[model samples]
Target: MASTRAWILKSRPTGMPDMGNFELREREQEALGEGRVRVENRWLSVDPYMRGRMNDVKSYVPPFEVGKPLEGGAVGKVIESRSPHFKEGDTVFHMYGWRDQAVGPAEKFNKVPPLGVSDEQWLGNLGLTGATAYFGLLRVAAAKEGDTVFVSAAAGAVGSAVVQIAKAKGMTVIGSAGGEEKCAWVREIGADAAIDYKAGPVVKGLMEAAPKGIDVYFDNVGGEHLDAAFATARNNARFAICGMIDAYNGAPQSFRYMARVIAARIQLKGFIYTDYLPEMGDFYRDMGGWVASGQVKSRETIHEGLEATPQAFLDLFTGGNTGKMLVRL
Candidate 1:
């Protein structure tokens, strides 16, 4: 029997998670039953939302159980297959992440199409990160051309995609990141203005960037960023509440400008990327065109080896990654 190394949740996190909360264990793989496929994961994704799963709470998704292997998005190659749906050496994307090897029903694995892009791109630009930006901006926020859009964490995977997609649609985009380097890259990626949130107050910077107020807001980091958006929003502004990475670690989020929600008539919608799975084909088509035309680009911070997965995930909270944070196994 073959052995596989996997990361198991040792305990639920109280605040920000640490290496002590996880345990790496090696286990023998079970027989590949009929209609099942075994995969060797090549790229594993570490997203901010995964942090919420570590807690024992009721949410849109079930919390991660202790003593079980953690799961997320992964792109792998079929090493063995007993199902007619897949063949040997096929590249597939599945939700059996955190483990170097995955074995499950063939239906859970989707074969990645040949789109002339790298395998990692499937986990970055063409994966859930890109999908979130697409639906959150264009569908949830209803952002349109000529709109002045504001996005938080603009150097991140979803936020970077939002900046580019908004710009491609002829919308004026203002992005906020942690540092000058990140802000510079945000501007280089077509943002009309990039605010360094770490330098000063977000509302102050946003006011200077767009004195006329913003028509749309794509929020990744909540709390202060959300408040800033509320303070500088024009009437009838649309807000897409994506991930609240700022308060994900059990931190309390206090918004003083929430009263503006009524005053500005702001339309705010919180969404999960899975909510629009029925329209994934639309996303692939449009995002594919933008990617091929060089209107959209992908950046990633990859940690080598499966052992580095925990640290990579921890890095997300510290702003250690400029774009998508992934583990290359």
Candidate 2:
């Protein structure tokens, strides 16, 4: 029985997650039970939505228990398996956590294929990020071909996918990113218009880009960005409510955009990715083909070592990573 190094949540974060809320500690590995497999994490994903899980309130996922493993989605290889579904050397994706190793029931994870994607992609494009974008923009927003789609946090994990997926469906995309570099990356990735939300008034910028008004709004960072998206949206537009990074730390009930939904007759849908697992196949099918054919592209910002997971996640809030951010464990 040996100990493993892991990052555990020491307390719930009220706002932006600070390094103090987590502790890098040693804990002995638990014995594998029947049908369980041991895995050494190869890569860990950090996303904007993870902030919501740090609070004590209810969400799509449960809050992390104090002094317990901080939950996260990860890609790992089977170090040992006691089940028929997997074997040593097999790869998998699971909602494990920020640790060097983990053990879960065989049915607790999905087998990761050695497809055209890398471990980073397992935590990114082909993982929850891709799934979020695929289902959120296309299904919830009901984005039709030729629609002008606008997304906030456009250079982020989910937003990047939305831009590409919308383009593939023949929709025009306009994105708002944090800065000039991110704006450039958004435009390079297929957005018809990439506005730097950090530049000036976001609402005015989006209006200049889509003067006729936007048909679809894939919101990732809410607060002021949501306000702007609402102000510029077309009548009867579809607004897909995703992560609200900007509002995640604010005072309760502080941000509101409901009036615009009623005034414009907009169809706004708030979604949690877990609720749409039935559509995962459709997401993988389309994303896999596009990846194989080079019809689409994804970027990964990788940080090495298990010790880096905490710091790597910080970058997600600061707009430090250009695309899907990952930590090589």
Candidate 3:
């Protein structure tokens, strides 16, 4: 029997996750069962959402069990298929990530479409990450032309998509990043204003960019960035809460401007991208056009090999990657 390497959860973390929490193990492949397929995973996606899954507590998704392989998203080629839906050499995307190879029921995998981009892009800009930004900014926030929009963690995968989409729609986009280099990249990606949130108070930086007020906010970092958005939002402002990376690793957060939500009549909607699954065709059509026409660009920070997976996940908290972070298997 052939064997494959997989990263398994060894222990749940109390705060920020460390390499000790994961153990790389070799699993011998078993014979394929009826209606099953074997996959040779080529790329693995390490996302912030997986951090929450590491915990034992109940949440939107099931927790990653100790001694078992951790999963997120992966792109792979079907090596063997007993099902009629897929065949050998067909590319697919599935949740059985964090492993060099995986075997599962055919229904567990979704066929990857032939988009004009690399297979890695399907895990990023052309996939869930991109869909998140598309639905979060447009559908949840209801951003439109001529609106002044603010985005936190603007250099990240989801945030960068929001910035470019808003810009393409003729919106005034204000992006907040950790440092000058990231801020410069945000501006280069078509943000009207790029605030280095680490340089000063987020509220101060946001105010300097949009003195009047912002019409929409695409929140990736919560806590302080949320406070700042509340302080600078205009009446009837819309907020799409995609992620609160600030509080992801059990960090304490205080929302001083929470009261402003009521006073300003702001609509704050917290959403998971899966909630918009029915509308994915819209996203593929719109975002695909934007990317094809060069209105939206994709960026990725690659971490080579499966051994770097744990560090890649930890780096999300440190603002280590520019856009989507992937570990090549």
Instruction: Give the top-scoring candidate (lDDT).
Output: 1
RMSD of each: 0.7, 1.6, 0.9
lDDT of 2 by residue, 5-65 (tens): 8889888886778899889999888898889999998888887777777888886778778
Off by over 4 Å in 2: 251-258
Candidate 1 off by > 4 Å: none
- List candidate 3 segments past 4 Å from native: none
Residue-wise C-alpha lDDT for candidate 1, range 1-329, written one tens digit per residue? 86999999999998999999999999998799999999999999999999999988899999999999999999999999999999999999999999999999999999997788889888878999999999999999999999999999999999999999999999999999999999999999999999999999999999999999999999999988998999999999999999999899978897899999998999999999899999999999999889888899988999999999999999999999998999998
Model 1: how far residue 237 lies from native, Å = 0.5
User: How would you encode candidate 3's per-residue C-alpha lDDT over 1-329 as one tens digit per residue?
Assistant: 77889999999998898889999999888799999999999999999999889888899889999999999899999999999999999999999999999799999999987667679888888888999998998899999999999999999999998999999888999999999999999999999999998899999999999999999999999999999999999999999999999898888887988899988999999999999999989888888788778889988999899898999999999999998999887
- Give Cα distance to truth, residue 32, candidate 2, Å: 2.0
Model 3 TM-score (2 dp): 0.98
Question: How big is the positional error of residue 271 in model 1, measured in Å on the Cα after superposition?
Answer: 0.3
For residue 297, give model 2's deviation from the true position in Å.
0.8
TM-score of 2: 0.96
Q: lDDT of model 1 at residue 67?
A: 98
Total colliding residue pairs, candidate 1:
0
Residue pairs with colliding backbones in model 3 are: none
Q: State the displacement of the C-alpha of residue 245, model 1, in Å, after optimal TM-score superposition.
A: 0.9
- Model 3: ten consecutive residues of lowest lDDT: 112-121
